[model samples]
Target: MSSDLSLQQIAESVTKSVLNATDKDLEGFQKIIDETIKVRESHRNLQRMIKSYSTTMIQRS
Candidate 1:
């Protein structure tokens, strides 16, 4: 399922989960890290889009 949560908020939740997790739960923690990377990548993509849009608008004006 998809979520409306922000990357920073999800990252913080994952961080807290990892801190309290046991050594046997490392695999799940790794999954959380992978998801966090995806979130960050998505944020980067959004930033790029905004920058491109702003540049195009400036050139038009």
Candidate 2:
């Protein structure tokens, strides 16, 4: 009976640990996704600026 209890306790601990790790991983993924979005937006803005400058230069020429 004691052995059974010990096994159950071990199983619960392992389950909790796995769940915590999964949560941490999800948080990391979300941060990465957010950063990637910001980077993409910045890139788009830079491209727009470059395009506008090129057009202005062409008009001047």
TM-score of each: 0.60, 0.64
Judge candidate 1 at residue 15 and give its lDDT.
88
- Model 1, range 13-49, lDDT digits (tens) per residue? 8887778889879887778779989999999999999
RMSD of candidate 1 to the truth, in angstroms, is 5.6
Q: Write the per-residue lDDT of candidate 2 for residues 1-61, one digit (tens) a residue.
A: 3445575786687676556677677688679779989999999999999999999999999
Best TM-score among the predictions, by candidate number: 2
TM-score of 1: 0.60
Off by over 4 Å in 1: 1-24
> RMSD, each candidate, Å?
5.6, 16.9
Angstrom error of the Cα, residue 13, model 2: value is 29
- Model 1, poorest ten-residue lDDT window? 1-10
For model 2 the local lDDT of residue 9 reads 83
Candidates' C-alpha lDDT: 0.89, 0.82
Best by lDDT: 1
